[model samples]
Target: MTHVIDPAELKRWLSDGAEIAFLDVREHGQFGEGHPFLAIPAPYSRLEIDVPRLVPRRTTRIALIDGGDGVAARAAEALRDIGYTDVSVSRDGVQGWQAAGFTLFKGVNLPSKTFGELVEHALETPHLSASELSHRLDAGETIVILDGRPLQEFHKMSIPGAICCPNGELARRFWDLDISPETPVIINCAGRTRSIIGAQTLIDIGVPNPVYALENGTQGWYLQDLPLNHGQSQTYRQIDTPPAEAVLTRAEALANKSGVERVDSRTLDGWAHDADRTVFILDVRSPQETAADPVPGAIPAPGGQLIQATDQYVGTRGARLVIVDTDGVRAPVVASWLRRLGHEAYVAARTDLPAASHADETLPLLPEVQPADLFANGEPPRLIDLRSSASFRQGHIEGAEWSIRPRLRPEPNQTVVFIADDPAVAAIAARDISAERGAAFRLAGGPQDWEQAGLRVVATPDTPADDDRIDFLFFVHDRHDGNKAAARQYLEWETGLVAQLDADERKLFRLPGIA
Candidate 1:
């Protein structure tokens, strides 16, 4: 029989030494708009296929939640249909969790804790925040406002004088940017993750000074209504419309006539090694995808956001660039987009990849899976989770140590398993991590796959333990911060959601002053 724990009790349990799998079966928009910090989102409709591909553990407990849309039970039933043994719905699903007094977060990721890690790391390396950045700009600090968005976006609207090229090429063609690392490199996106990842990438790859995210990029700029670049928002018009076939023919002719060399992936990777050369390697993938299997030295700027956010990326006014992607298609689009903006650009090709797949999409992979107990076996490879940061932090394999910051260039020193919400991204990340560091990597069976595979997941208590192990209950004082956040975050946990994880026998840790 499944256990039903109340919101207060559940948080305590999680903070203790338990390992629990969190789920929110709400619709995509609802899930995207707001959810708990740790709950990995699996839309009620796509659970069947996506679950198995994402979660690979067989021993994890399932925490099923919903918006009380009569789908919680159905989702749980589906979990059982898919062979999940330990499943329970939120007390009243989303309603109950919310009623319990937990705060919900808004973003594409749940357990929004990992973003903190990204920020911390970026800050660690000569980074600055939006507020701090404003001071520098006002004071005339020699700075580089790089729009990590694509060229079209840069042309459409961006901070005046910011260049394009998106996040993907920050390191791929760092030398191409031709600015001293000491020049403050500030990056921005429409919102958060991309900018966070982009800024972190520069710091991780040994950029001389600090890097920063504009916090909220163009939108923030607009929300503040501070000197808008309100030209027609034709961010992609130049790149998308193209310069006609004749223009492309002319460029091809120029390449042929000038005999300029076009290098492949392996050759480009070799060229990128020289510190003297500035190569900003751009990986064209979503921030979440980049998190799962990031190109160790590559910066991410998703294809869609590239255009509008370009001005925030290109660093200085006139920077050359080399763009990369999972395959060659995205690179040229971005490269050509940059060229249209009058920035020197090219797609460094790769032979190992087919013409269709031949760009700087190269990334590292994870090590093979030896179960979460790999540590108990005495040969613990560093346990790095590919799951979204919030998901990993709110709860994950007990005792598994993780570096919240996404690896810009992963080294191949240890065995690693890539656990994520998507198998494709996990597989790719694992493969890239492996390829780069030559480390052993494997895909964590995904959420549904874990239960279907009959793997065991420890139940996460809603509380913390003295030894830092996750238990079943973290007591909510009358006026504590945890009391508020947890209440709003797991509104449904108090009702049906709480019923799933609550256990009277699973007591919580009380404070010294508690009666």
Candidate 2:
């Protein structure tokens, strides 16, 4: 039996300073449109896979919410099945929270986005409009543009000639760029948060160069009819030498100002042994560095992305975060931002920790059926394509019905065969459907296998329709797909987030001069 928690009580639980996993189990589209201020999205489609990482401690208090469609109940049952001892569902989910007179924030990464806006307002972070930068470039100005987004995002689209240097690496890699101290620097991201944060970081460090964030970032450039380069490989190179002592001192002072604590491996062990507290050990290094030599028992969370998307990495609000990095530079920089974001963040003094073991629960494998065997009898088994709706629309095995984990519906006692890109999704869905649906089998391979076997494949451009693509967030993504109105709306949304916060929500941020 599952317990029900009302909206007011759940809100109180969040602010009580205890570790709680407040998860919203709705799809991405629904989650992005509107959700509670601190709710982390753990969509029901991938509940088991995401919950373990988000809330590592199975015994932690977990509160699940949805759109009052009983999805929370289903998710609660799933978590309980996976060894989560303390689980409860929101009384009526988001609808209940609204009725109780709480704000439902629009957009994801609420805390981080709001903090970015507050930082700009408080610090008066200097910025340059896209037109201003463009004119300067045309005049042969010696300004250097640094794209503060990750390399992958930079590869997708960036200002022509911009070099990829993520915000987290800006402090450590700034000297390696070999630009003159007098040269002006401009930092940009897809939108505002990273650009502002990156620029403010340099200014705080007291660099000699003139630094300015590109206002509205790439979207601002697009609005000005500026060209963007795709597939660019320009990025900061790895340096053999360590950061300068002055740089390290400045970073450590900034971390101290934000109330960041430096802890050694023994201290981390003590925190891990505490049954009442939840501690997340995150390695705040570059992906390549972590892959080459990862710290034991640490999840790799690249610093810039982690600060930008804290809810994705750290699900348990108010929990202890131990950021690990080999260099003294990156961890402190990342921890300072995290502390201001209202998390109890600390940097690891050393990186020698014992490896933690994870539960290896296995899912029952459904029998596999070849394409020829799929239609051996007179009638074919009900073919359910569990691939993404977008992928299904691109092309799928002929006569296959598209469905997702949460929305699967099969006839009673029906023979079913699942075609999916990820076998795990199919296996989870197979375990979910009513047992009376008879035995379930997966296509030996996906649509590609069927195509290889000379089976018919079909495409339906308008099959799922825009509304049914709940897995994708069109509100945030449409701006990238050449939607001018969406781009403007998104910018407006980003600029207006700070004003939407309630008193309690606003109090979470501890910016300069704010008590």
Candidate 3:
């Protein structure tokens, strides 16, 4: 039986959580011209050698796709002979995805921003600017000119009525102001990403107020020839706390000593939105807390699991590492472990906290499925692994393409069944991300559940760059060797995958334009 999906509705399915597999049967050259994110390469010419290898699970919902109906039809029929129970041909193929106005992925990154129209995420907070405040203030509107510069700077000069709410204390002290959401809060700095981020911080953490940056910042106010007040700055020295700079500096100083790196939380929000983030993001909080809410692309691997899963976890070996957790307590421990392993670990610090101890960890890891399991079952029902990219590189199910974090791009209309080790975490991410264009699905028990159902797993060998005659896969299987021997094998294999892709001359003209 073949499964059909409307191209226009695919976005909805992805947003809603459907697990249908999309395969591009077109030739490498044809695919290179343009193709969808979820489309895996299984050239029709390799039907005899590759089809069975790539699609071991026959029961999956499959879309046999090509430049037109002809090759897709042939591939679909052959898949049936080989026991593929569900498959269908897209009436328009790659063209159809385009016709639907659905963004197509070109690089390893998915449909990118159109310069300005990139998605504005719900997880992030908003900021206000001086111009905005001036406009509102001039309009006789109730607005709070919350001066966010340091006490020294505030005493030097600031806008009229601008309260001495230092940028650093907004998280803790702003609460004392009783600023309502309706009252817009203006944030300012000497001029930098911090004050901008500070205003944004309150906005991100459920602060109901509309906030803005002082355009041009404190300088902007002066440039506009506005009045400046001095000696009215608020001081927190009597509170017996570390100065704001010292508090923010602790994260860096500790990181320097601990080797846990750092990333701008604001910019991270942008990367998280693009779906090109292939890093592993770990939150050391309890499972329940992580489930309640988390940074968009982060996974919960409490300190215990994080310690246990490090080597095989991909964050240590493959990609960059980021850490976030409850009040940043567990992150240092986790970061210490990864550092001992000689990995780069970073903390995605929470803007709301003065101490970085509550920061979370995020790193890219590969999927955890064996290659043999993938091809053993004849054809998978519907398959895709949703782990980090670093995880995908170590070892994965045979024929299971690296489609995990920052790499797994399912069409909106297709029902994509995701395989994650933790269904709860995946469910959370799926809930947040899948709601984007609409259409999404959860695999219930994830890869573990699939394995329990007698699915086989294999450690996939490196794929050649120009094996161009494949597409329309039914099932994607994976296997991971978290041990030393497996890791050694992976090091050798990654060297090869990189070399072949780099060496092959035909590679340029052969594969789709995706990275």
Candidate 4:
């Protein structure tokens, strides 16, 4: 049976110093528009698939919030079916929270973005305007630009000649860069938070070279009509050698300053066995590094992305985070930032961690029908495309209808076939449909299989329509697609995030020298 908690009770639970997975089960677009400050987006479409990764401890207290659409109750049932023990639904959902007078924040990554703004305000992190940087470049000044975003984002667009050195790797790899201490360095991201956080990261580590965040990052550069390099691959090279003693010392000192705990395997094991607390064993290294040296039960969360999008990885608000890495430098650096971000973060060596069991639940297999077989019976089966609306707009099997789990409905006698990139989504959707209707089959090998079979495909830009694309967030998406007005609006939203926070929300940040 599912329990029901009111918004006031949920709010109190969040501040009670207990691990609680306050999840918003609304779609990405709805969740991005507004949600409780501590709410993590676990859409109803991918609730089962994401819950295992977000809240590893099945017994962890979870409260599901929706947009008064009854999705939370459905999510609660799904979680219980997947071995989740303690789960509840927020009474009346987001509407209830607002009715209780709590703030519903706009935008994703509220905590990280707000903390970035607070860091800039408290530390007065120096920055350079786009026009100033442009003039300096024209003057042939010795300056280096480091793009703080991940390589994928950097590849899309970046400052000309900027190197992709994510903020997490800056402290560890700065000494490896063949640059003189005299050369000035500037760190930038797509917007304000990362640029400020990345630049301030270097300053906090006491780098000898002058450092500044590109004010407003790529958006700022674009607003100035400056050219951005596309399809760039320039990035910091990975070094097998351990960091220098000085670099390690700096990382350690910064972590200590932030009061990040240093724990060994024994402590981690004890915490893991503690039934009352939720502990996350995160391997904060590059994906390649983590794959090369796999740590048992460790979730791969690159350090930079972990800090920038903590909600994506961690769902429990007050859980203990044990960050692991092969080297001494990366974990400490990440833990320092996570500490400042108001998490109970710890650093541990990969060699010291003991093997632990990981979740291995497999999706139930669905009956598959070959693309050619789909056409053998003169009339084709009703095709339900479970892919993203954006992908559906780009191209899809002709006659297929795009739908997500929440909106999918098929007739009891209809022959429905699901086409999806992730088989799990199709499986879950099929399960739901089959419970009410008859059994449903999936397209063998998805749309690619249909294309290879000489089937007709079509593109319909207006098929799902903009309003129905709840999985996509168009608010900050258009900025990179040459929408100057959208870019300006995004920057304004980021800069104004601090003023939107209430007193309790502002108290979550723990900056240096600030009580």
Candidate 5:
């Protein structure tokens, strides 16, 4: 049986310092709409796949809320089925919490976003308005603009002449620019969090250049009616040689200032053995270097991407994270950023750890039905495409319904066929669905196979069914066609998070002279 926890009781637990996973089991859209200040999104549709990564400890105390949409009860059951021992449903969910007069925040990544606002307010991080920056460029000023977003995002849209130098790359790869200290620098992203973090990274490390965040970033540029360069792809190249002596010295001092730990191989092993605390071993290096010397169990995440999308990597707050890199500059810089995000992050010393040489596992041996065979059946199976809602809407087998893995509910005599972009995701969905139904099958090569076989695909603007949950708000600009209004709302909402954060005492944002 599942236990129901009241809003007041849960709030008390948080106030009283209990270590619990306060999960909001709603779609990302619903989550972004409003949720408790500390609720981490764990969408019900992808619970089976996401829970292992988000809540690693099977024994951790977890409470699920879903605004009384019945998702919380379903998630609790799913958690128990997956061996999660201490799971409970939030009493009345988000609605009840609101009725009880607690704050419900808007937007995703509130933790990081709010911390960015706090950093700016506390540290008075400098900024350069898009209009002024644009004017400077137009007047032939030699300002160097560095886009702090990921390469893909920078490629999408950027200020003219802005080079892609993602957050941690300001330390790892900025030397390649070789510009004089007198040349003023500006950093930007689609919006606030990454740009703020990136600019602050430079400021914290005492970079000789005058670094400033492009106020409001590319969105601000668009709002100002400033021209943006699209599809431009100038990116920073990795420096294969050892970092310069000055870079290493500054990185060490910053890490010390931020209270980042420097651990060795033995310390990593000890943390790995600890049952109480969850530990994540990440190799913060460029893709090329890690590909050549991959650590056995360490997840290969570039320093910049890891800091930008931290929730994707480290699930649990307060978890121990040990970042690995050979040259030492990348790991320490990223570790310092993680420290600001309230993690017990460490930069691991260069040790002769064994690289992974094991053979990769073969694909799962699951029953496959070709598109031609599927269509030729006497009564065609009820196709259930297990891809994301967006992908399904873009194009899927005609008459197919979109569904998430492990949450499919088939009707009597209905034959369900799972399909996804990745065969692995399809296979996992097939396994879970087949366990409930007597049999399940997947498209041999997913949607691509269906298309290759000259089968018809359809597109629709319809949202997923009411029962379906949108797993993630993949982009910050994912609202109302990503228009100016949505961008403006996002920017305004972000700036206001600091004030809301002042009321909530749970956040542990440590900035210079403020700890």
Candidate 6:
């Protein structure tokens, strides 16, 4: 009974600055395969759990799409059931949007990536190609390579002699860089976007060094058959110097340009008491720093990733964002970027904020049935494997059917048992299933437990087509199968993003002087 919106009208609404949540209700993996550029991931399975956090306001315009999977209709119903006042589905889902001749973005965080592209186009960010940089390194040129990716990513693989100076810390730790102004500094990421943004960040902060992004980044290096150093762990630590006056002035100017607001502890406390508003207080610092001396209640989200994947962290578009940093430099810079994205962001530095327990504090332990017990029961429970589709196909219990967490539909008479890699996800799936069906249980340990218990598992020869919905698009290097083809495809996809931005006339991203 949900109303349907035509793709043309939706596009018009976007062009008109309509306040709406355009959500793709397919699984995250499926959504990642291809989707409308602005469509946020709101998989049909977790609609009830995710929508409230994402939209918050009951009257917000909500448009659901499923790429013709038929999940959109069900998701639309669920939204209405949860008291959402305005809800509708795309006329033909994602296909409808495409059939209407609108652009469909292939990756998550399109806004951030598009912004990076715009930055490169407008500012003409400097770059050093893989071959050129490799030759310079071989000749022992006076250069410093700073990897802008996270420490974990840096640990996996990096160009030789690259130091980890993750975004946000670049300005704060500039003096610690310990290089002459004439030294050529290079920055890189897994791909192009972060490399462009990171290099531009240093340039904007007025670093005297001649900065350049490693053209096309690590993928470019791999494509050129260049060697990469694995298991490298060079990282820059904070020097704890008082915030420099010049850096503070730069942050203030940027904040003023973006019209970012400022908040105190009292204002934050008042917002926390408002039931109608959703506020996210985040600590924009390095993982090592946050771990050593944690801030209570403030979620740990490094500034770069927060900007790169804002949808993942802050679901509600109109929600208030409070950024925290021990040094004044990082928070204001992050707030400035958030403001550019049309968020009501505030920068604050206060030690009196309330403390919150760890995010994983209160997980309920579900009743678990051992694999041996499950097989020997009078009536074996219906096995529901909650692993990724790709993982399930690799090896699963002989009769187990692959299932997603939020979309599990247990039969009233069936005794269901949930299995997943993580016990926490499995426990939640069990609880949700039990709410609908009379009884549900979880496997004691997970798939590993089944194998250790000498249970028979079979691998399917057929590669399941990722047609209906894919929840995850595992990085090529991260995939246990080591799909070099996936890596190539990802690089190709990323390479084309700049051109896509050029064609899309609706994007509103603006760099300081570029727009």
* Best candidate, lDDT: 4
Per-residue CA lDDT of candidate 2, range 1-515, in tens? 87999999998898887899999999888898889999999999888878988998889999999989888888899898889999999999899999999989888998898888899989999999999999999999999999999999999999998999999888889888998999999999999999999998888777899999999999999989999898997999899687889989999998998899888767877887888888888888899999998676788999998989999999998899988788788889899999988999998854455457554456666778898777888777888888888899999988898887778754557788888776677777776675653478888876677888888999999988888888877775778667778889999999998777887787788777544
TM-score of each: 0.41, 0.96, 0.26, 0.96, 0.89, 0.86
Q: Write the per-residue lDDT of candidate 5 for residues 1-515, one digit (tens) a residue.
A: 78998888887766444456778878776787788877887776556667776777788778888968676887788789778998888788899989988889887777778777777767788998998998888899999999987788888888888998878678877877888989999989888777788888888777889999889989898889778888899988765788789989999998998898787667666666667777667888777778999777677888877876676666665667788888878888899888886777888765734333234444454467888788776887778787778777778878888877435553445567777666556655554454644466777765567788977888876757534545545345453234887788788888887666534343566665444
lDDT of each: 0.49, 0.87, 0.48, 0.88, 0.76, 0.76
Write candidate 6's Cα lDDT for 207-317 as tens digits.
Answer: 899999998788788778788889999988658877778888887777777788777778877886775666778888888788998887777889888887777776655
Clashes of each: 151, 0, 112, 0, 0, 6
State the weakest 10-residue window (summed lDDT) of model 3.
Answer: 110-119
Instruction: List residue ranges in candidate 3 displaced over 4 A.
Output: 1-132, 235-515
C-alpha RMSD of candidate 5: 3.3
Q: Of the candidates shown, which would achieve the greatest TM-score relative to the real structure?
A: 4
Model 4 score (lDDT): 0.88
Error of 4 at 273 (Å): 1.6
| lDDT winner, 1 or 2 | 2
Error of 2 at 294 (Å): 1.9
Better of 1 and 3 by TM-score: 1
Candidates sorted by TM-score, descending order?
4, 2, 5, 6, 1, 3
* lDDT tens per residue, model 1, 1-515: 44455666655544454445567766555665556655666655445545543332333466777766556666676567557677766776666767897656554432122332323343452344555666677898888777766565565567654555466555444444558767877776544445655575555444576577676555455444445453433221112222344434443443333233355667665654443333445566556558887665555666534433443233222223556555443455445434433344566643322222124322333344635444455775655555543355466654444332113235567666555555444554443354554454554555455545544444444323222321112322111122444333432222222222223211221112111
Model 3 C-alpha lDDT per residue in residues 1-515, reported as the tens digit of each score: 44556675654433333334466666444554456644556555444334443443346556766765566776677678667777777767777777876544432111111100111122132445456667778899988777655566678766778776554345445555656769877776543333444465455334577776554455545545556576776543223233255334443444456466667766565544443223456676555557777655465565433443342234112245677764443465446445533345677665522222224323222233343344454545346555544344444444455442222333554444455655533443343234442344444443445456655455433432223212211111110111334333322332232222222111212112322
Q: What is the TM-score of candidate 1?
A: 0.41
Model 1: lDDT equals 0.49
